[model samples]
Target chain A: MEHGTTEPGTAGPENQAVPDRPTPTPAPGTPAPGAPSSGAPAPVAPATGAAEEEHRPSPREQERERFRRSRRRRDTWIAALSTLAFLGLLAAAAVASPGWDRVHGLFLDAGEFRAALPEILQGFWLNVRMFLVAEALILVLGLAVALVRVTRAPGLQPLRLAATVYVDVFRGVPTLLLVFLVGFGLPALRLQGTPSQPWVLGVIALVLSYTAYVAEVLRAGLESVHPAQRNAARALGLSGSQTLRHVVLPQAVRNVLPPLLNDFIALQKDTALVAVLGPLEALRVAQIKADYDFNYTPYLGAALLFIAVTVPLTRVADRLQRRAAQRTRAEAAR
Target chain B: MNEPLLRIRGLHKRYGSRTVLRSVDLDVAEHEVVCLIGGSGSGKSTLLRCVDLLDVVDDGTVHLGGTELTDPRLDADVARRRIGVVFQAYNLFPHLSVLDNITLAPRIVHGVPRRQAEETARGLLARLGLADKERDHPDRLSGGQQQRAAIARALATEPELLLLDEITSALDPELVGEVLDVVADLKQRGMTILMATHEMGFARQVADRVCFLEDGVIREEGTAEQVLTDPRHPSTRRFLSRVLDRR
Candidate 1:
């Protein structure tokens, strides 16, 4: 750490603090470490306009730089140690069987993997449709149930309890059991014509199961709305329903968007559960291709398809979350 | 002169085992401003809520402008429309723009046309010194601005009685003056305000009558000058002393 010096773009310690600094190049003809003037410590302040490019450091900033150096060294050592361990494991696995060579051969053929893409993506589109429909149903049903639960009306208590029990039972049961129950048990009960198709049953199952979880999300969202909002609306002579529709639901919905998007992503992946009911979703397509071709390339193709959809959606959600956080921070600063 | 704007008789409320309001009685003359002041948990808010039918009294009669508000047989909704309330927290809807927040109730509750409601909302916003903020959400406004917008929202219906419950309590020290100033402006314009406030200075300056509540009952009631400057009740003196010492 050293005393202050003028630097045009640099902010003082009290203002505009940031974590990183790019290294500035030293001037030409600077003395090396063991040169004639190196015996004494360097003087910080000089006569007016002497190069004016020497870096100034405060005591705290100097300590921080030293700490940063040590931490970087520690991280570098950890990375090197982990890399060595991974190489050793790879060597061991390779020696155990027809190993690293096979793995390399499996991954290096990009052409074979790319050929199966059209078939995999066809199934993946159907999976997307199933996810969207299920998520829409879940969101609407969840919001209605959450609203009923928060209502002050005594008559809605039974309805609210029924919704709660429904959410608990559906969420508590495994998604596979739900798909099976809808696909197999519904036909046995003679509830529908030929139990519908497996894809339909899968969608129904996902909607039912996910709605329970989404309802809790909506409940939390509704709870996040301040009570004064409701009170203010009521003071304006609005009815209970009007107050909820006008004042509570809109804000609650915005607060719940990120989590709701996350649920949609989860539902997208979980659509593979349709395989249990016997439709070809992305995973099922991968399975069929693997079974027919007797190769792992088709499965990899399907994995990439799933990643393409999910990764972009996650990025969008992340951007929205950051914007929301920034808005909150700005409001706090105000 | 036919009936008082608000009248409460034999009002009672209890929370679990502890009684909060015990047979409270009060009346507000036509277009009169009444201030209810008390220590915490003294039930001023509860009594005020009961008058608006926001809370139902155990055994009481609450009449607003000659219509019985707490009567089980009457249209409580209609009675409620005649009274507007402002809470301590401003309570503006965060999702809606300032214009929408002010107009939402009129359009939804009273079946006012959107165009007419918007016009009325703009007028109220202008009156509240928020004409330029109609497009902004509540989060964009300062605490004082939000409270003022909330007051405009409550007044959009032209309610016969305005109930304000600690309207400035949630404001920042710098913001409190702006909110209290609005309240003072309202008082001067002869708005029939029933406020439960901790602002002793504002109460002394504006309130027509001050009622001191303790243990769910009015311990003392008098003109603002007499009640604030020359309190006869020991509890009132104790309360004033504590509040004054802090200042």
Candidate 2:
């Protein structure tokens, strides 16, 4: 929000190198380094010259600075008051409704919430455990599938076909359908080594479903890296495998971290879908408590727990996306 | 009088229906610098890629010393080990610091010890005037600085022949001088380099011999002063005037 001042190295080697010629006027459209880098307000001309350092503010300039300060404060106050008014109006409308007393007793009772907390928290650990296992397997399998899809090796064709088919099938089927298929369907087959535990079956189904999505995310990342990067690595005498390992995958993974985190957040929430099986996760526990008391407050407790974990992950993902954008913009400016 | 460090015989390359290079023959003598010059789509970059074994030539043979690099059975990776290439875009691995970018092939592909790789990388960086920027990533450096770091990287493996594909084309006009200066310095060190360039001025100054490519063929080849200023081929003269007129 301030006028430009940060172009310290005014006389770069380029200027020094061309001592015989005055600095070529930057090609027609190139922005001056002193040009405002962002959309923030700039009330003064570029501060490249030393005259701006010593010049005293005129009466008009002093008045403008005062105006800018007061305008910023007023903007902040307007934002805060508008948000508060919106939330207050929503709360007042809800409390003033005709069914407020019955709805409040059924869904917002503190005693029902307290009674449900212990069992729900205990069952929530199962959801956490299932997702953690599923997430790890998903990451490894996703990367494997991505590698298979991107590799140009002749010998891996059959393997690539299999990977492609796996991704197509899993991604085409819905996750909850996959959960049902693996949980109820797998057990019905009565096959040897089929996990008897619902949570284990849930994790497997979660892995299969999430791996498909993550694989596509990772494959896009791998393909997003420029072909020139691969040529550069190979030209450096690196084998194709070495190039993929060192140069290609590192850049691909960095490029896709935000999307990867997004998939992880979805996987974390989808863990609750395991409640369809016999295992008592937080959602199932809440279902049981609500059925027993004819009160819905326990469902709120389960929702709050899921939100508690996912919100932090959402924030982290947003931060990562912002950092990636800033990095690309900075590179483009250079 | 003596065998050249690199020899290309009847080199031909094609991309599906389009022939990018045709019957191209060139050589780089030991300690010599050869520059390829032409307009865009003139096959200059493809020739460099084929010579470096980054692109598989459709026909003919490339010899590095006594090794037939273009032989069907040849391990391309092994052949590539003895040749260094810097692309026009200065493809320094963005994820790595300048030091790591330089040391990657040395420490990983060539199996040099980490300590020794880093030492040699630092030396190359210092030589290329990027010593202080070794810890910075590619995006953190200017185009000229990144190109310098890329040159440092190509030299880390101590390749016998260096292939440069219009290394300064992507730089700002002002930044071009710095990259060209690095090439000139490498020429001074007696490196056998085959380069493609758009800068007729720099090519004339640094290249011992220049080859002009047109329509997938070499139309002219001679000393830089002879080919650039006094061309025998009409195509070469026309290309030269078009390029040299703007600057």
**TM-score for each candidate, following the candidate numbering:** 0.80, 0.90
TM-score of model 2 (CA atoms):
0.90
User: What DockQ does every candidate get?
Assistant: 0.28, 0.57
In candidate 1, chain A reaches a TM of: 0.69
Q: What range of 10 consecutive residues in model 2 chain A has the weakest lDDT sum? A: A15-24
True contacts kept of each: 0.55, 0.70
Write the residue-wise lDDT of candidate 1 on A18-76 in tens digits. 33333322324332334324445543444344444544764444544565666668778
Provide the overall lDDT of each model, using Cα atoms, as 2-decimal numbers. Answer: 0.79, 0.87
Error of 2 at B148 (Å): 0.5
| Every model: Cα RMSD to truth | 8.4, 5.5
Stretches of model 2 off by over 4 angstroms after superposition: A1-63, A331-334
Model 2 lDDT per residue over B38-92, tens place: 9899999988888887788999988999899998799999989999999888888
Clashing pairs in 1: A2-A57
